[model samples]
Target: MNVELSFMLKKMLSVALMPWSIAILLSLLALFFLYRHKIQKAKKYLTISILWVILISWAPFANLALKPLESSYERLENIPENIEYILLLGGDRNNRAWEALRLYHKIPNVKIITSGHSLHDPISDAEKTATKLIESGIPEERVLMQAMAKTTFEEAQHMKERVGEKPFILITAAYHMPRAMKLFKKAGLNPIAAPADFNRPEETGYATVLQSKQLKNTERAWHEYLGILFYKLQGKI
Candidate 1:
């Protein structure tokens, strides 16, 4: 499949898999069943649909679902010796760039590769992040911006082309690390997972259970799960 087409498809898939989209879809399906006079089936579907929305929106349930993905790999206490590059994937999230900066501070000689494509925005994510890194005291010479990759699979491919077989730390959100690792490996790059942007709650309580952030977290978790499945189906990982 063409790269642009794949990127668009993945974006569409992400929107469709979001919590609100899934809830709306389920509710619509329930209505259809009801119209067909399958009362029991309609009731079952409606009940599940409502509960699914509520649970995903609820903080406790969302956190529970996200915990496994966030904890899939532990954070590195010390940068391993001889790592040449720190590969940061592109997203609106700032934690990824912060993580890259942290690694750069630890390994001052390591090159940084910020990869992301220009979607609807005039500035590519890579360039945006690269600028931030430079402003944060990273020398411009040490930062490389790869502005052609719009997805994790593309990021792996581009990184491999730029630094073939060289060891690099792959930095992304904690929930996204698993899929990122698989794609990087498939692209034949040596990636050391450097997950960041952990969304885990520090404590659990009655008030925490009703927070709106849970809905967003659940949506993010679902996005990763769906991305993994789609990538597997496409043989990208």
Candidate 2:
């Protein structure tokens, strides 16, 4: 299969397999069964859908799915003495951009490289992130934008061209760091993981609270898990 086509297929499959997508698909199937007067099957599908949503949204289950990924690398501390760049991978633009900014404060000499492409929006994520960094008082020249790469593997490929053998801080979500590190290393670039957008809280309560936040965390972790598997099969990591 062509690489771009394969990437799109994987994305579609991942979106279809997300928790909310599964729940919605099940609900739709239940309605179809009801229209056919198969009341028992309808009830079974509906019940399973409800249970699936509840299970995914419960805090304990979300924590269980997320801890392994988020804990793969501890938050980066002790910036290296003379790093030249901070490579901010694209996702959750605000928090990740803020993280790059904070790191810039600590190491003012390092340039920030924002990497991502536009998806449904006119401006690319890389440009948006770079604009945020510049608005936060970082000089325009200090922020670079590589807006063509749409996936982590592509980002690593671009970084290889831009900064091969240079030890740079890599900024991305905490849960995504493990996969990101592997991809960058595969591309033969030196990336120091600086994970941001942490999903797990310090204190998770002992109750199964049904909330969207927990569901979001579960979805994020699920995506990373799927991404790792997909990349492994494709020999990207």
Candidate 3:
């Protein structure tokens, strides 16, 4: 499939498969059933829809699904002396860039490479991130942009082309690190994981209240899970 089409399809699927979307879909189906006078079917679908929304938004339920992904990789300590670059994959741009900025301070003489492009923005995400880094006091020369990659698989491909087998720090969200590592390694790049943008709280809590933050975390976790599965099916990992 063409890359653009594939990306579009993935985006559509992602929105469709989200918990909120599923709940809405079920509710709509229930409405249709009710219009047709199928009361039992309508009631069944409506009940499931309500339950699904409540479950996904509940704190304990969300935490149970999200913690594993967030905990997959610990923060990078004991920085290797040989590391010369930090490949920061873009998502939650501020958080990821903040982590990269912090790492740049610790790692001497290292260039930070930012990768990602946005469909809705005219400027590529990489260039935007690079500009932010420069404004944050990173030397403009030390910030490189690889903006062609729109997905993790493409990011790995572009990084491999630019860096070859050279080792570098790979910074991404904690939840995304596991799949990011797999894709980069498969692309033949040696990446040391520097997972950041952690979504899970350090202190565990079990609350029955519906929280939007918890729902967001659950969505993020499912996104990674779906990404990994999609990549595997496409034979990219």
Candidate 4:
């Protein structure tokens, strides 16, 4: 029971990360100040207002932070010689999932695994990914789904139970790969990372990359940065 409670905390902590940004942070502090002199009702209203924005942007914030982490797995070099299974992580987009499925089609006798959970994400993450892979002419038998996992740690742990004695390739965003790999390692699964969906730097100037969108990107990067730290503290990785 303590373990399950801790897992839930980590999951919620991942979403709460967006509000840790300066934009939301300052807004929260300002509201706290504004409520200091106000009635209880005013304090409640302000609290509600802040929570709403935080919830609304959680997904986008996650998406933003994940950009670079998503890119870390991208390999310009040709495929290495010994991969036997490919594991794709789930998110808003199936970018890595599609890539893994494609690789499955190209390779010989390799299997694909999709790990996900139906939590805040309404769409079935692992199942949706598996559906696509099966549609692509890869035999249904070659795909494995670990649908019960909601966190990166559980995803890797559960995947190991399903996949044994195969050279596995784990696909996820580059920034996320670091933490995911750590979790996979802790789970006793050795997986080579395959990252996708990079948030690239501008060749011309840093200014272009520092636009509002980029600031948002940094907010997301900060989230992943902080998230990894917390995971480390908890030994979740």
Candidate 5:
């Protein structure tokens, strides 16, 4: 079953990156060659294989999936003065939690929902986030932690259930906002976005071009976009 799943994932990756026409053509050629030859033919496929790997793994292409999230975040004016809670998605260490917690402090009487998957009993990220907030002087009673959610969909679902009739913010990486918002919306949560850790913010011209992080950022962006598409196809998000 693991082998079958791996093979299916490999097929998805190849189909996602290569155009349908090319994949079909290659499949037909591969089938033709599979008829009688026990030994694999010659080596002409290596160059194409290398190019595909490079394109799939490289930076700017990766951000294809993440850019829309970045744009959604840039559209907000100051934190809406009436936010009820702030939902911080877990995955990062101190930085992401701190950034969201800062906002949690700013809004008057704002509750916080920190969500993550806990592999251990006593070491949840939700607890870490809550502990940090309490140390930061926010009352312990005001912070809420949702620790059972392991994936974005489950995180949003948990938040939606907890957030009954409340306005909240979804804080995550700029590259992740697009898919995060989509999932939250689907889960029936109208969480506002508070995206952080942007590689670039409103800069134009050659600056975006020459920065090393741009490529890195773009790669991350595309990964999320690919994930969103995959989830959509699977009806998981």
Candidate 6:
């Protein structure tokens, strides 16, 4: 599939699979059934919808879902030898860039590859991140931008072409590391997972059950799960 189309499909699926979206959709269906005078079915659907909303809104539920993905790869305490490049996948740009720069300081000789396409901005994410690295005193020549890639699969493909058969540290959100590693490996690149931007959740309690942050975290976890499934179906990983 075309990269842009795949991205769009992923976005659509994300919204569709989100806890809020699914709840609202189910509620709408319940209402539709009620309008048609199917009272029993309407009540059943409404019950299911409410239960789902409650289940996903709970902090523990979301935390349980996200924990595995976030913990899929632990942070590397020591940067390994012969790592020729540091590939940073785009998400939270500034944080990822900062992490990339920190890695650069540890291994000043390795090239840094920032990958992302433009979204709602004239400056592509890769270019913007590369500029940030340069501004931080890293030589401009050491930063490579793969601004054409809009998704993890595309990022893997582009990086494979640029750093073929070379081992590199793969940097991305901690929750995103698993899928990124799978795609990069499938693309025939040797990737050392270097997950960053870790957001450890607070202890789960009754007060956190309906918190907006928990809801957002649920959405993030669901997005990664959906992305992994999509990649599997497409044979990209």
Q: For model 2, where is the 10-residue window of minimal lDDT? A: 200-209
Q: Can you write out model 6's per-residue Cα lDDT over 1-237, one digit (the tens) per residue?
A: 986786788788778877799999999999999999999999999999988888888989888888999988888768888777998888445377777877888985889988788767898888878888888899988988888877888888888888898888999999989998999899999999888877687687866666777787888888888888988998888
**TM-score to true structure, per model:** 0.87, 0.90, 0.94, 0.72, 0.68, 0.91
The parts of candidate 2 lying over 4 Å away from their true place are 1-8, 202-207
Give the number of the best model, judged by TM-score: 3
**TM-score, model 2 to reference:** 0.90
Candidate 4 yields a Cα-based lDDT of: 0.67
Model 1, range 78-193, lDDT digits (tens) per residue? 67898888888874375578888878889858999888788688988888888888999989999998888677787888888888998889888899999899999999988899
lDDT (Cα) of model 2: 0.87
- Residues 1-237 of candidate 5: C-alpha lDDT, one tens digit per residue: 674466567556745654333434555555555564622631233345444444444445445534566777763448877888888788445378767666765788888777776755677887877787778888878878888766688787777678765768888887788888888887777788888777553334332343445445645665676768877987866
Tens digit per residue, CA lDDT, model 3, 37-138: 999999999999988988888888778888888788999887888788999898435468988988899988999998888888898888888888899999
Error of 4 at 156 (Å): 1.7
In model 6, the Cα lDDT at residue 113 comes to 84
Assess the local accuracy of residue 173 in candidate 5 as a C-alpha lDDT between 0 and 100.
Answer: 81
Candidate 4's C-alpha runs over 4 A off are 1-8, 19-22, 31-78, 91-94, 120-123, 203-212
lDDT of 3 at 188: 93
Provide the clash count, candidate 6. 0
The lDDT of model 3 is 0.87
- The residue pairs that clash in candidate 3, if any, are none
Candidate 4 residues 1-237, lDDT tens each? 686687788666666665434345556655676768655655665676566455434544445455557565665236667777788887426366666765776678887877778856676788887887778777899888778876777787677777664557877766677777887887788777777656664333322322454445555576678867877888776
Candidate 1 lDDT (Cα, 0 to 1): 0.83
Better of 1 and 5 by TM-score: 1
TM accuracy, model 4: 0.72
